[model samples]
Target chain A: MRALSGKVAIVGVAESDQIGRVPDKPAIMLHAEAARSALAEAGLTKDDVDGLFTAGISTTELGEYLGIQPKVTDNTSVGGSSFVIHVGHAATAIATGRCQVALVTHGESGRSRVGMPPRVTPPDSLRGQFEAPFGLPQPVGAYALACSRHMYEFGTTKEQLAEIAVATRKWAMLNPKAYLRDPITIEDVLNSRPICWPFNLLDCCLVTDAGGAFVMTSLERARDLRQHPIVVLGFGESHTHAMISQMPSYTSFAARQSGKVAFEMAGVTHDEIDLAMIYDSFTYTVLLSLEELGFCGKGEGGAFVSGQRTAPGGAFPMNTNGGGLSYTHPGMYGVFAVIEAVRQLRHDYLDQGIRQVPDASIALVHGTGGVLSSAGTAILARY
Target chain B: MSGYKKPLPKPDPVTAPFWESLKKHAMKIQRCNDTGKFFFYPRGLSPFTLSDNISWESVSGRGVVHAFTIVYQNRDPAFAEDVPYVVAIVELEEGVRLMSNLVGVEPDPGHVWIGMPVEIVYDDVTEEITLPRFRPVRAT
Candidate 1:
């Protein structure tokens, strides 16, 4: 596994206002806004973007509307982790000299918008439709099954899951851009109405109408830019299935296989990671990712998350931007994960009354798509 | 397989047999004709051979609990009445796992252990549908 160090860098990152409901705003507007913000952050305009990569948005329609003909464009929609996978792909493209600058963006009014055309339902050949009609229609319930299984197998109490929500809400309180900044507690998480067994309303992520984008450029190009470049050190990806039940192991994640590759490629160990931006579509996700990413041994995630390990100033500073659990989850959260990693590496929010991980150098960003179905991990470093 | 409602009419080609078998109080799994590999939650093709030579076979619906959980909360609104239910992933005799509710026993997590013997029992919730649930097999 070759390290991608110094081959490509995330030059800029930006996002749209995190709002609960933007009924009238088209999804494209959110994407365009984030795109413009990212270009500005990179000290470049839309004209400098030779490639466009988008997730959860209509690429052909958006590309036509943006009025910038891109030499390369990709619309890889792997659910929430689409943008993170795009970052890996864009890094490869930049390394191979296919495109100098690539923009990866995502936007969705998932809270307010309704009736978006279904992109790819699991094939009729899969058991998705059969199980879907049997009351497991979406990923939430599917993940709830895994949560229940986790609880049964490991004696993981509901309060333990609540700890993740409480920790994330505390971080959200300091993030002005976070959709839900109100302080929350384990009691709030426990008392909040249950959406599914083991998952309360607070345990679920915010359904925001937001967008986010990241601008990636070659290392040589980024070196000439004004701000410090966060280089893409390494990345790994794996996909099992779109349906949750198809996963081989309910307790273990396929992320270990990918995370191992990424870590090996980056030439860094888990101990060297200064910051981590794990995708938190649900509280259990973070717990599972922690175990899979080698933060703790297998089956020890239940006990590892106790004692505020993932909280601010803890052993690991994770999801510093509040994460999707408390901040904003506008359908595809992969873009926001990268955006926060870049910010943490750049030390951008230090003066915003937010607690910062001092001298943050290397950050790991992970994205899980489609009901624990696909995992993408990337290592970002500031040099 | 008599009590639960029939699943909403949808074209689930691969799992039609599994569902249709459940209606008859039986459990079926797909086995690859070429490689003799067994798979569950039915797929259109065999995972090992990638061949479409797959056929449904009935299982004894008897196995050990690979993993089990006593849910203090129920997921479906209809099952809300059945709180504190036990759902276990039973590894069937055919070497495939099925997620089904455990019945006919007190729901206690402490009393359960991995590799505990279990057997499937059909609950006739509705005339057309029989829900396959598991129960702890009593010690001989």
Candidate 2:
């Protein structure tokens, strides 16, 4: 396999025109808005783009909306991670000469629910037949089950899990665009209303309307662009189960495989990673991803994240964009994750003193989609 | 399937047999002849072997609760009336897992623990559909 290390560069990244709450705006408009912002940031126009990738809406629809006749397009909507996987796809597509100037976009009116199409998972489909009838609760309920099992198996504590939420909110305080910046404590998390057993309302990600976009091209082309190029070191994705029931193991899932592939492809180890922007759909997700990504040993996620280790002044800085817990969590957060990783690499945060990872050259971002059924990991480096 | 209050499975060709058997109050899962593996949520072929050499067979219908969660609230109206319910993953003797609600037991973390024995029981919620729920085996 051809190594993706430093082959392609992310020239520009941006979020939708407005996030948090745009009740009157449609989903497609957010897509177009983010796309225009990202393309302009790259000092390029839609006419210069030859490839487009996104989820929820068809690439053709997005292409038409953006008014670009793309020669290559992909709509791998596994969930939020779909866009993360697209980074690797676009990189390879550029490497293989499929297309240049690839644009990946995501926009969802999660809370506003305006101009969002109805999703119908066929009743006889894997989810509807096996999971729907069982009253297997949505994301929170399903993830709580995993957290409960992880605690039972590894002696993980709820307080240890609460540390993740507490630390992420601390990062949100530095981000002016963050949806929630109020300081919270472990007790606040525990006292929060219970959505599902083992998971308080604070333990879950926020529901908001948002969009994000990214532009990828060859390193040769990116150097001429206006912004510092964040290289795509390596990327990997995995899908094991659609429903949480078939997850094989609660504590371990696709993140294990995806992380391994990404690390090997990047030729980097966990010890060398300066920062990690992991998908924080739920607090348990951050904990388990840390463990599965080999940042820490199995069942040590609780101890690793304890004592504000990932907080502002902690040893390891993670989810500095506040994460889905406190950051804006549209339906799909993969693109937002990529956008944050790029911004951190470019020192784009307004308050770099608190938000930036000092001397942060290598960063890793991962996304979990479809109830932990699918996972994608990307290794980015600023040279 | 009419008059069903909750979401009902419109079984396709591959799953029609599974739902048909459920209507008769008999639970069946596909067993791969090659690998001798039993899997649930009936599929067209063995999930492991991916071969058509499969057979639907009956087992003890007894399983152990692998994990569980008590839902305080749900967005679906169908489950709004059933708040504070126990949704659990049960590992059957056949070595396959099934997601079902724990019946005949209260939804409490202190009360429910892993490895709790459970058995499948059919709940005829609609005329053409029968839901398979699990209860503590002792309560059966």
Candidate 3:
């Protein structure tokens, strides 16, 4: 179970110099800027990177922009969680000596639309044929469908969902770089305009332009790097169905499969996790993921997250960098989640006046992608 | 059908029969010949057995709304006019589910509920294309 555990460590992590609507920086430029920054932080040059991983953008494009020739490349674009899944892949490559140093990156101009190509789904595709014809505004509609079912089955209420947005915003206020820093309340979320039934506009993540990158190397080499190594103790990924309609169950997620593998490999229990960075594509994403990740019993997430349990000064500190809800969410937000986890574990923000989880030694980062179709869970530790 | 801006399904060979059956106002689902299990969103091979032992069979279009959402914002030019529409996933009595739109009822919280009985209704939006939607199964 611990084959790759502690064998690899994330040596450096950084976000693009500019995020949250940089109209001038194209998507590829964000990738380049983040890659450069992360490499520099690791005390390594682009030449030392033997593996390149990216999503939404191709490895070829990223490598050319960074002028690095990687011996191995992975463009596993499962959706937003693609970056988190890449960390698992990078760990495997490093463990097998397929590559010594792996660089995982993400860049998306989700809001500014700079250098972003037009998105087109062929009419003959599965989504085009089965799901797209009903005028369902994707993503939100898809997530709302699951939320509706959760409410029906588990009595999850708008109030319970609002608690998530409220808690996430609290964290956003503590970070200077967050896109929406103003505090929000449960009432504020419930009163926000409805985009899809059961999903108010406030419950959704921000649409912004951002890029993030991180470097991974063998644990032995990581100890010599510039930063404290956040060891990859366990990692697992799973995919069920791409189309939301085909999701095995509306109340549960594929994360159940992924999280089980990760926790078992890491040999850690829920009580030992010091912090969590769960994907917040929507409020329900967090609620359901908590349940599926075994943080709480099934159908109990609403009650579990009530009273801002995940907010600052609460029992469980999560998404301290604000998360996709208030932080920068380029088309995919997984890389940023990993970056925040590393910072907290390394105590990088201790003097920055930001709220880093005190003495956070173990962290659980879970990423969801493609309408909850894919999940990737990673357990990281500072020891 | 002029100015019909909504998105349309483009059927391939494997899914053409499902679309063709809708054109005839008779919905057909794929069933595994070996397992005798019906599946929606037709495919050539059985998902259970991964074999081509599959057959198309007609079934009662009666179902229930398993879940639904009233979409208020969709920026697609094809669907802009249909804002505040009801998009749902209906589970058929045969135990298969598919995505559709609810019609003949208001797209409001007061109207739609999970497990509400529904039946399929075909809409011939174009001369060659037909969409299968759903509506409440009225009490007899």
Residues B1-140, model 2: lDDT tens digits:
36667777777888877777877877777899999988887888877878999998977778899989999888888888888899999999999998888998989888888899999888888877787789897853
Docking class of 1: acceptable
Q: After superposition, how far is residue A232 of candidate 2 from its true place, in Å?
A: 0.7
True contacts kept of 2: 0.75
Over B1-140, each residue of candidate 3 has an lDDT whose tens digit, in order, gives 55667777899999999999999999899999989888878998999899899999998899999999999888888887777889999999889999999999999978999999999999998888889899999999
- Candidate 1 on B1-140: residue-level lDDT in tens? 54443343233656678767877888787999997878876788888888998899988889977654454544456556665656566788878776666677776756766677899887665654555777888888
Index of the highest-TM-score prediction: 3
lDDT string, candidate 2, A66-155, tens digits: 888888888999998899999988998987889989999999999989989886667767788778886766888889888889999999
**Best candidate according to DockQ:** 3
Compare candidates 1 and 3 on DockQ and give the better one.
Answer: 3
- Those runs of model 3 whose alpha carbons end farther than 4 Å from true positions after fitting are A352-354
List the lowest-lDDT window of 10 residues for candidate 2 chain A.
Answer: A347-356
Question: CA lDDT, every prediction?
Answer: 0.78, 0.89, 0.92
DockQ: which is higher, 1 or 2? 2
Model 3, residue A78: C-alpha shift (Å): 0.5
Chain A TM-scores of each predicted structure, in the order given, are: 0.95, 0.98, 0.98
Compute DockQ for each candidate against the true complex: 0.25, 0.76, 0.89
Regions of model 2 farther than 4 Å from truth: B1-4
- Give a tens-digit lDDT track for model 1, residues A266-362: 8889889998998999899988998898988877887877777778877778898899987789777889999988988898877865468788999
Question: How well does model 2 score by local distance difference test?
Answer: 0.89
* DockQ of candidate model 3: 0.89
